[model samples]
Target chain A: MEALLEFLSFQDPSVRMVTLGAVILTASSALVGSFTFLKKKALIGDAVAHAVLPGVCLAFLLSGEKNPLLLIIGAFITGWLSLNIIDFVTNESKIKEDTAIALVLSVFFGFGILLLTFIQHGDYAEQSGLDHFLFGQAASLVGEDLIIFLSVGLLLIALILLFFKELTLISFDRQFAQTSGLPVKWLELLLTSMTVLAVVIGIQAVGVVLMAAMLITPPAAARYWTDYLPRMVLLAAIFGAFSGFSGALISYVSPAMPTGPWIVMVATTIALLSILFAPARGIIFKMKRQQENQLKILTENILKSFYHLGQKHQDMKHRYSFDEIHSIRPSIPKPRLKKGLRVLEKEGFLRKKENSYRLSAEGTEKGKRVVKLHRLWEVYLTEYLYLDPDHVHDSAETMEHVITPELEKKLEEMLNYPDRDPHDEEIPYT
Target chain B: MKKKILQADNPVTEVHDLTVTYDRKPVLWDIDLTLPKGSVIGVMGPNGAGKSTLIKAMMGLLPLASGYVKMFDEKLDDVREQVSYVPQRGTVDWDFPALVKDVVLMGRYSKIGLFKRPRQSDKEIAMDCLRKVNMEAFAERQISQLSGGQQQRVFLARALAQHADLYFMDEPFVGVDMATEKAIVDLLQEMSAKGKTVVVVHHDLQTARQYFDWIVLLNTRLVASGPTKEVLTDELLAETYGGKLTLLNEVSQEIKNKEFPNREE
Candidate 1:
């Protein structure tokens, strides 16, 4: 708690620098990743992240120093190389893109590990925290690192703001953008460079292995909230910055916990929560809709069964017992049937008297619509589509509960207001 | 106020000996076409007849293996601003994070130029185009909320906002409802009346006759290109669609199967 308070207070310059570095790096990555996610090129971020390690190691070896700028250039070069190789392999050969991505990612990451181990045992003096690039060491961030992040992050945000329309056009429809006189190739190159820059800036704070998560997760979470690009991008930056800040503090407060994985865990938790709870596209909303549909179908089926019984007895007031209803639909379990009955009664659709149930006035009108829709659909299918009458009843059974009043009117008009179904059964009217 | 229609000396679009290939397999072969001004022309062909490919190649979206495209009697690069192309309905991600107004405003991006935001007049023009397509009600709605027909209308409104002399549309009517289809046909006629050349890659043979006054029937090659009344003959249609082109079918099949034997080496 003390560590977290100190980190948030900015009293400790080192903790302040780490938090600020993480915020900018993750914000930039999340902004860029929104486009990458929409383009369906998310795995490319992974490949580029892994491909930058060897460049960082080689940059250290050649420069004989721990200069952040030199290492960033190295990371960008190798990251760009990996992207070009993937493009070349996909364009020139028969190998599919997923396979090519896998090959490149494993090879580059494996090579990076080789160089990393060699450097660890060598006679280099300042190579103590170099291996932290694998996971990340947010504690190692200092004044110089935050400066690099601030400039590069601000530059990327500016470029995205300048070319927002062009980037969006290309990502959504490259051919349309090209025909609209946008220089699609240059736009693509610009976007690739930005993505590479994001990955490079992010690798130091989140490390190569987990940087891809920083790039993709926040935007994915934000997508559930809104469908406007600017809002989505803004929300993604906020989500990423929040996770980055919290992850840094949590790691700082807890010993032996790394910041990169913690950041990823926090980001993933946000994504999961968004997926489960967000309106319009979330799982909970979908499940509730499904449940409502199931209830509607059940209510209609019970009403339809009652309508048949009433007609058979030549009486609209005919009351049916539990055994009689059970005999009509044996497929419905007893508990479910009882529940349906109770719900129907509660909704004023069914009335029970002395263990016998009959449709109320409102329920009778509803039953007529359901039955009319079924017959109308069956007739339209047989007459319009030339389907066998036998084949259409099953389909009509399902459509009866689903067809809206507008569709029912259209079906009746298309069938010329038919008075009878294909079976020559009289169609009821409301 | 009527818009000034440019009376350029060159035809709207002209292609000479155009050939396009994907992975060394020819998709379009030796196509020659000259489209004049103020007409709704339909490029008609079967499933693999390279109808969409012709527009893509002509618009310079895809690199041509041979031949060149002239737009408004000038080179494509020089006259790009004067042309608009609407790709197939399935080509774009409708779920992209944008409102209907934002997408329609994209049509004005060329005029807005790089680094400059759209003006209020541009926004009004975009809204005007949306009203033309009966989509003004959806202007502020996110694009993903639109139905398939509404989405097609949005794309048409975007093209209309371009105010281009030449337009290319690839199967705009494929999935839309009847109301949208009628609206598109009316829009095409209106554009034609305004002296703009509109080229559509179409599939329905019945509607092609009713919708266009000129037609280009293709089957990997130009089987016929002329007025609809003269070119849509039984013999030309047979040549364009008949199974007699077995060799072309075989080649297209090979390419579809992706058999690149030499690529392994």
Candidate 2:
């Protein structure tokens, strides 16, 4: 952690420039990625990331050197062609979309690997740095490379902001977008081109193998944190920028670590965290809510049990023993008895009269509501769900605590205000 | 029913011998229909009958194999401002992370032109349309959280925000609840009463007679089209539904054969 702070405040001009460039590129990639993720084309980013490898290698082979302009052109051509081919194959042929993506990804990547091997054994000695494209080396981004990255990154951001509405429409509903006379086809083409441009631009920094992760993970993580598009985009960009900067810093501090893998690892870690810790949708939060609900149900059931015992004893001064209450509800454990009784008494639903419990006036009313809801649900289950008379009791036994009062009334009305459940037990009135 | 063109002084949309094909196979063959200036027209057809293709062809969304589409005596492109379209519910990804307001604001994009941000006026128009659809409360809500009926309303509100003189809706009632269906029909009726042309691609045969003032029955070709009372006879119903199962089987077989040319013994 201290090392990270030192790197951030480092006086080195070269480190500052690299950090700035990484931040810009990462923000640009995540902005584009949000739309692509929303469009349900997350896998398309993976395909394009791998598909640009051959173009990069071919440009390197033909030019016999690493020229940024030629490489970007070649990468764009290949990426665009791969997208078009995927479209054609899916439309004209019976192959599914995943298969089409897999086909193109493998074919392009295979050819790229072949070219890379040939280059490794060929006469060009300056091609040693070219291996960085396979997996990124953020430490090597210099003045010229940084300029190209920043310019493309800025162009991408500008296009996204300018065509924000059009892209949103197309991503959400292409058919509607087209019918609204919004040029759906051109917008789709533009979006795909922008994604390709982002992938190609980040190849030297994030690398081909992990470029797809940068495009998808940030948006996926952002989705857990936000429901709105603009916010999602902004959050995704922040996550991406953080990942890029940390990855670059890690590589800068270390002697021989690559940037792409560390960046992906960090981004993926953030995504996993969001999936578990997000306020509404996270698994941990959902479990917590369920546990609380179960606790409420248990407490309510205990109160209902005390009310029933009080009515059975038929003495205003009656004090039922704990073992007797437990006998009525055998499933409840001994540990919960004290807690349930204390909660019932605190809520004015029960009274402790010398080591025994009796239902207060409020307790009787509350118990009646629960019993009414349970019996109504049983009737509903028997009538609406077509469950056998005998099969309804167990399920309604569990649902009694959760059904709202409004639903209980509707169920009563629907069942013609039944006075008794399927078990021939009298349903207490509210 | 014999074809008879309306003698209105100014019709909102007129399609003359409109033919559409996919890869040289005819999907919609020679359809001649004219929608009057102020009416709610329902286009009904069996599955795969090119009902949606007809709307797309008219909107210039799909290429016309052979024919012309005129809006208010002008070509479709010339009168694009006067037209709006709503596609089927399933044609888009609902999980798209756009707010209800943002989706509706897209209706003003063509009017706003390229490279300009939607201004305050555009947002106000969108909000008004949302109010009309009873979805004003959902303006800031993400579209994924909405029910099928609410999604349809939002789409309708988007089209309404366009304020186009003519609206083409494809399967607008698909997946919509009965209440939403009633609300949308009522809205369309109000639009027609106000001298707007609303063309909808509908599927429910039961509601066809009651909801629409005009009907166009299609089965890869125009089977019958006219006022609902006159054209939707028992004979036309037979023509639309009769032999449908056999036809579907044949089409499926043909597709299989085309996909696998060497499958035969």
Candidate 3:
């Protein structure tokens, strides 16, 4: 924790500058990334990131040294070209989008590797930091490099602000944007250019392979937390900046760790946590709600069975054997028997006498309603849907849990006061 | 008919001999259409009948292989200020993170221009549009949280916020619930009454007569087009749906030709 405080302080100017640069770059990329995420073009960033590698190498070969200006220009050219190629292959050929992405990604990455190998073998003395492009070394960013990153980041942010409305319109509805007389072609080009720029700036801190994660995961995580686009963008930027700073700090503290993987790891962890814990859409919460619903259905079904057995016997004390209940619900598993019994007993719907169970007065009424719904659905499905009598039971079983009482009455009327199901079984009274 | 005449007095849009193609295959061929200044016109067609492509071509969303579209006797760009569009519901990503009000405000962007932030007037206009669609109460709601019908209403509200003289909507009723559909129809009628020309691509045959004053019935080309009562006929319906059996046979033959090229038997 003390180490954390020391890292947080800007007492060391170099550390302060690096932290500032990382924060700016990450925030810019994440902000643009929010739109891409919404557009479902998350993998486009990956394709662009990998596609920039050959250009970076070409720039280095031409300049005989690491030139940021030449490299960025070359990266943008190649990134744009790669996007065109991806679009061409997807539209012209029968190749699916995922396949096209994979094809472009592998080919460009292979070319980059080949170029890097050629550079390593050749007699260029100043080609030392070229490997930094692969797994980013944020610690090496200083002076002009930091300045370039910060400026580009600021430019990206400014462009996003200026064209926020147009971008949203195109992203949401390209057809509408076009009809509304917005220059959709120019807007698309602008959006693609911004995304490439974001990816290029991020390659220094997040690296090429994991840069796509920085572009996608933050916004995806933010989506689970909010529905508003502006709030989503802001939250995604914050999450991205947090990941960037923490990853850089961890790598700074532990010299052996790579900055890019750590950043992606942090971002991915946040995304996963959000998917499972978000208030409205969380997986765990949904599962819990589903379980609660299932339990309610099970108890209702048990009460219903008890009521039917009581109506036949005309005695409250008359009990039903487990076998008799199982005969009524042939598809029910043995494990659910204990759970169903426990819920019924807890609800005062059933009282177990030795090995037999009987319905209480309140339980009898609820059971009769359930039986009525089951019979009504069966009659409706078989008669209205023209399903075979044998096929109606399974569908009715599923529908009984979800079909409302209002739907039940509608189904009843639609079937025109049917007396019997397709199986010749009698429907219960109101 | 009374509404159409009042709308015709304004005379907002004109299309002469418009043609469009995709990959050299004609989708919209030699189409002559005109939208009066203030009226709700329904564009209806069977599946694969180019209802969407027509709207797209007119909007400048899709390239026109031949002919052109004019708004108030001006090209699309020159008259952009007077035109607004609402696309099919399925065209957008519902998962987009934006507040309902934020989306509605986008209509005002063309007027506001670049680098300038939306002002209080823009906000008020956006709010008014939302109120027009009865969605003002949901201004702060997130887009994804709304139902299909609500989302359509929000999109309609965005188009309304544009405050343009002409509006184009594509498949606004698709996947929307009955209540939302009724609300949208009512809103479109209101827009036409207020002297805004509105064109919509519609699918439901039952509602076409009730919803639209003028109709354009299409099947790859114009089958019949005029007022709803005159254009929609059993003969036209038969022409649209009658050739399916022959078309299927042609498809099979094409498949055969592809499988065995240059067979001399």
Best by DockQ: 1
Task: Compute each candidate's TM-score over C-alphas.
Answer: 0.88, 0.88, 0.78
Q: After superposing candidate 3 on the true structure, give the runs of residues whose Cα lies further than 4 Å from its correct spot.
A: A1-13, A67-70, A84-107, A123-125, A305-430, B1-10, B44-46, B98-154, B172-187, B203-211, B219-225, B228-265
For candidate 3, write residues B11-127 as lDDT tens digits: 567777887766545566677766666678888878878898988788887777678898899998888888887887777777676788988888887778766789999999999
Q: Relative to the true structure, how large is the alpha-carbon lDDT of every model?
A: 0.86, 0.84, 0.81
Candidate 2 — which pairs collide?
A: none
Q: What range of 10 consecutive residues in model 1 chain B has the weakest lDDT sum?
A: B1-10
Top-scoring candidate (lDDT): 1
DockQ of 3: 0.54
Expressed as tens digits, the lDDT of each residue in A1-430 for candidate 1 is: 6766777788876777778877887888999998899898999999999999999999988887888899889989999999999999999888999999999999999998998899988989888778878887677677786688678988988988999878888888888788888888898888889999998888777889998998899999999998888899989999899888876787578746667898899899999999999988899989999998888888889998898888889877788999999899999899889888989999998999989999999888888888999999899898889999889999998999889878888887787888999999989986
Report the Cα RMSD per candidate: 5.2, 4.2, 6.6
> Per-residue error at A392 for model 3, in Å?
7.6
Q: What ordering of candidates by DockQ runs from best to worst?
A: 1, 2, 3
Each candidate's DockQ score against the native complex?
0.67, 0.57, 0.54
